[model samples]
Target: MIGRRGFLKFFGSSIVGLMTLGGYAFGYEPVVRLSIARYQLTPPGWTPGLKLRIVALADFHACTPWMTADRIASICARANDLGGDIIVLLGDYTSGTDFVTGHVDHRVWAAELAALKAPLGVHAIVGNHDWWHDATAQKRGAGPTFSHKALADVGIPVYSNRSARLEKDGYGFWLAGVEDQLALRRSVRWKRQFTTGLDDLSGTLAQVNDVAPVILLAHEPDIFPTVPSRVSLTLSGHTHGGQVRVFGWSPYLPSRYGDRYVYGHIVEENRHIIVSGGLGCSVAPVRVGVPPEIVVIDLG
Candidate 1:
């Protein structure tokens, strides 16, 4: 039906089109940011005049070549760009089984990661992926896959069922973090046998100052339901904002909390919950409508 000239024209156009799309796909800036969440929480000691901005980075499944040390540097630079007084990483820093294969160099990555800095400081917590390995093989000071020491070495304190005290402008707050629900649930029997004490939110809360507003840095957003109202704000990352929301709806959110909280800010009773979409995709490398995110939250 088509002549030779028409066929050639069409073929050439198709090639050009494909090349254009390929360029975009493989471009150095292929990474797209989904959203920027902003919120204000007033700590109890509440001086109306003070303001502190905190940037949150989470779920960096860095196994794929796409998430390189350069990419992490970019994220840190962006956080600095956002005027963040402090930076927080919600975990899942590495992806795949590098510890088993011995193919991934975590120490090198840690050295590169140490470059990230914020005025107040960088804080972090472990995620499901970080702990989904054989713990018995770990060396002391080496957190699951060397996450604990690596992050600590980078000046980012890794909180695993622990608490830290922070002070800013004469105001202080207690930051408490707990193990991920999925990880805890999966390792219930092992915890009992080892007597290591399973994740106890109640015990973690006991460490906080009752009067000051407590900020919780939990890896999984699913833990919000069980969290008591005593907490002022909860920072989390795990859902990846459903990863692939279509028309504002995500079809494959595997979280127990489900579609109700694929991403963003949610207020519960007296608690403020912020679910960061995270920096990298999990299970698969492709991301559709839901792009990655770095949450910037302000506390006054």
Candidate 2:
């Protein structure tokens, strides 16, 4: 029923709009706007005058076009410049998924990450992707992945359901790393075989004193509830801030609790959780309202 001129106008406008959006998603949004999220925390056993800075880098899905080894090296350089007391690396180092796969020298990537310097040292934990791809390759009866070994070679201990005590200038606290929850879920399978893994929360906490202020590192924010109130703060990633938030909502959030723990700082009673938007994309390589970021938590 439409006239020729009107139909042409409408079609042309639609094409133009799609092109613009495509450009932003595929180009500008993916490359630009590396954000730094800062939070101030006053946990249980804090001396009023002393301040500690912890920088968290999460979901570095390396080897993608937008997230190259050079790009990761640059990110480490930027993080080093921040002068954080401790640097925490949340997982997802490789880009092996149904939608996309990337290959890079694990040694090279590890070397770049090894360059990062912090007083309290750099610590890390694995993510679901690491489990899915067997980044440690413990599934095939093979040993840990080259990437994991490389990280260890650089003195960055990647904890799995373990606790490490860190002290500086007579002030001390516990840093606990919980294995990825999805690592144990039977649904996370490959080639018709279940990737039976383990994430013992109680085992990780058992080494720590109940009254000691603890900072937990977990890849998925859903574990926030399982964490006892004795733990002061928890840092996490894996949702990618919903990856493509439109008007503060996303259709494809990779979370078990929907959008509840999508991104940013979340507070519950005496506990706190900071979920980073993370450094790379999955499935489709694009971002809308959500931007990749490095989170800095300052505790006093």
Candidate 3:
């Protein structure tokens, strides 16, 4: 029943008030066109003179608008700006929305992502969200094609407890990626087993030879507790760094160890873990203190 003038005044005031409360306003925008952050990782046996810059992108629950093709294109454009030696995409690529053949249509956004060229290429790992979306549902034969293959089809190799070697500036390091713990939880818990070909933390670690500095790609930070000493640095993305965190605290965390494993760089003995906030929203579309992120890690 409100007139146009009255409605305008009320809605405008509400938006302004929300902004004051740390929420985005009607015209709200990020100061940094893209939220770019940096971290330095010093791992033992790290390739000397490596100076490798890695851009880590994660938790992209590709559900159209939120992680639209355009957004992904923007991400690629930005990563190219950094000129990182390698690009690492730590999983959670799809969300609740079902896909065709258990995977998002790679054709929709793959080219843009592939546009991001790195000497070592782009690597990925599955996340809890990926498992929930990829595996067969209770009543369904197969949900959709939302698995790692989606990325692989576009030339991005999604590693599940696998090792890939990358060399930069004549120095090389081992890039190890693992599957989500939740995906392997069944075997780990009841069967005391593992999904065939899935990443076995111990087995994957054994492949690296411990001679080269290893940078592990683990989608969930909780895997940190289980990682072997062979890993010198681990990059993960499941926490989204508490996607909606406030003052460095999240309402809940799924880390097997605890929330302390939620964000930033952590040093456990000789292993260093860096948890990226990621580039897409999951579960909820809104992001508060935890802005979507693109992390640039320099390994020297």
Candidate 4:
């Protein structure tokens, strides 16, 4: 048995250690670590030695203490400096929590994001948070627009269950974007709530030619399994790399597939998915091992 003094000393040391770690996770980690993840993708039909650079930015969740409008602007500026041929914006531009409603002026965000420079142009897709925040109020009567006007107002085309062909230097590929899978909430009550919307994968694919390579933009990685093998790559950001990873594992990953598609590159049966750690946090304003990131994918 341990003496009283010894037990007290041990308990005190443990408390101090936990506090220090908490401070690091909630403070320094969220603001300091912005990583650039590089990947090489060789989609089907690509000519040998030919490559394309795609930069992906996701989940800004702006207006928070760590991810303010100024921080968002800075992040965009940094992405521009990366010299990517195409830039893809995966959604969740605002935070959502009881304390913070995850609201940001779309017009103002558009101005800052418009500064992004990409040779192939910038394209975007909507996330669940955008739908929750009702970012598509202008087109609500018509259908779910998901920040379409806001992004388009600044020259960024928003794709919802649609596909677009991008060609450059005699090479081209098909890009498709789908609506948020979790956006069709009919009620605010937790137990009564259910999703009514479903992503139209077939509708989006119908616009693309089968001969060319295809890339997809989806807010949630849970849609990966349903994606056809014809899609060369899929980019997503909803998990936020579990927000806080302990020993390289996250317990709070919000996905049907759990940590299988949490973050970084995941390859399954020749199809690829890259889930960005993202630029902001939701629910909780802290990040542990999984720092925010801007993904830079080089395809050859």
Candidate 5:
């Protein structure tokens, strides 16, 4: 039912398209492209006249050819010039994929991150990969994971199930960082959904003893459902914008919630959460429509 000329034409175009797509996914989007995603919001309980600019870097799966120390230092320089009051590292600092030629040392990347500067200081939290890859932490089924120690060594305080109160221009707010929701994840037959983790939302919130609005830094968006109204904003970055989103829809989301919390800002019942696309690749060193990003949030 088809002529040879017509069939050949279709085949040629198909091959070209596929090749273009492959190159974009494997080379361009993953390595060449980086974006800045900005957000402005006014959450409930936010202090009036208190404007906070937060520059968030997430999922820096640093590796040799992909994300080198020089690349990280460059990113930190860009962040430092953003005029943000504070900076937050949203975890997954280590390489998420073994498809790399060399491992970027923990100390190396942490030292590059040390270049980030802000008046309110730098804060951080650990992600699942940070816990899973640490040999001792995985063996102990707990942490002070390698990521935590690396960050601490650079004087960047990691908020592992902790909360810190901060002020900007005499207006106060709280920053709460929960332990990785999927911390110490071990591959087992019976483990799935919300199991084998170290996140303590209740205990972390209880540490907040003031009326100041709360900003929670959770590594994964899976905890967004349980976030209470007391918290003004929740920022997370484990999804990597589904790692290959298309037209704002991600086909293979790692989230249990699927596309529900796949990426970007989501508002439910007046509670808000921003799931950043993050800055590196995982499982595979490839990205298509969802290029890496640095999320900047302006809050009042």
Candidate 6:
């Protein structure tokens, strides 16, 4: 229905638009933008009149030209300024993608994270990449990954299938962290009996002997469906908002449930989970629509 000139004009415009989008995804969002995402919710079993501020940093995938030690230190400084009641690190500290020119040393990143300050203290959990990158753990088909050791050496408690008790004012609650849900790979040499995860959700929850409500920290959100109502809230990060979401949906979802457990606050059956978009890239170092975020959750 158009002439030659009109068709040429439309084609030129379309090419320019695609180029702009590609530039933003590859250069701008991943490299330059760091956002803060906040949520306020009162979990089902949360104590009345008790407010908690949780600042979370996740999926740093520390590598050159993206998440450098200086950048991590800067992020930590900003988190410290937030004065959060508790600070949590939701793992994947090692490089997620091999597109880096250099890998940031574990000690260097750990030291930068050491600067984080919180009244209830800083807590950490390991992600799939953390386990995958550990040569010793992968070879042996067991844990105590380098990521765990690094965080522990820096005074941050890396909760691998464990629970810790904490309080604010007169209110008390429990914090539990499970091991990575996708820790080991099923390989021929590894034997057919190799397990998928290092996680022991039941064992971790069994450690909670008291009546305090529990807040569970997981690096991946795929465990939400099975999370018991006994847990007041569950916090997670790892999907990175599907890394390159478009129009609130990602064509490439990393989880088994696809976009269902991809990102943001999801409430089901009176239970709650806050899945952070996180601060780094996975698979590849490109982002569109979903920018790197530092998640701040206000809970009661």
* lDDT against the true structure, each candidate: 0.70, 0.81, 0.70, 0.82, 0.90, 0.90
Off by over 4 Å in 4: 1-5, 47-49, 101-103, 135-146, 188-193
Better candidate by TM-score, 2 or 3: 2
| RMSD score of candidate 6 (Å) | 1.6
Per-candidate TM-score against the hidden true structure:
0.79, 0.90, 0.80, 0.90, 0.95, 0.95
Tell me the tens digit of each residue's lDDT in model 5 across 79-158. Answer: 88888999999999999998998989999999999989999999999899898888788776778988999999999999
Compute the lDDT for candidate 6: 0.90
Q: Which stretches of candidate 6 lie over 4 Å from their true place?
A: 1-11, 192-195
Please give the lDDT score for candidate 4: 0.82
Question: So what's the TM-score on candidate 6?
Answer: 0.95
RMSD of each: 5.1, 2.6, 6.0, 2.7, 2.0, 1.6
Worst 10 residues of 4 by lDDT: 135-144
User: Candidate 6 residues 1-300, lDDT tens each?
Assistant: 999999999999999999999889877898778899999988888889889999999999998888889889888988888879999999899999989989999999999999999999999999999998887888898889889999999999999999998999898899999999999976676663664988899999999988888999999899999999999999999899888887787878889888888899999999899999988888888999899999999987
Candidate 6: which pairs clash?
Answer: none
TM-score comparison, 1 vs 6, better candidate: 6
TM-score order of candidates, top first: 5, 6, 4, 2, 3, 1
lDDT of the structure predicted as candidate 3: 0.70
* Candidate 2 wrongly placed segments (more than 4 Å): 1-3, 44-47, 96-102, 135-143, 184-197
Residue range 49-152, candidate 4, lDDT tens digits:
55789999998877656676777888999999999999999998766554453456777777788999998999999788777767343224234443667788
Q: Model 4, clash count?
A: 1
Q: How many Å off is the CA of 127 in candidate 4?
A: 0.3
lDDT of 2 at 244: 91
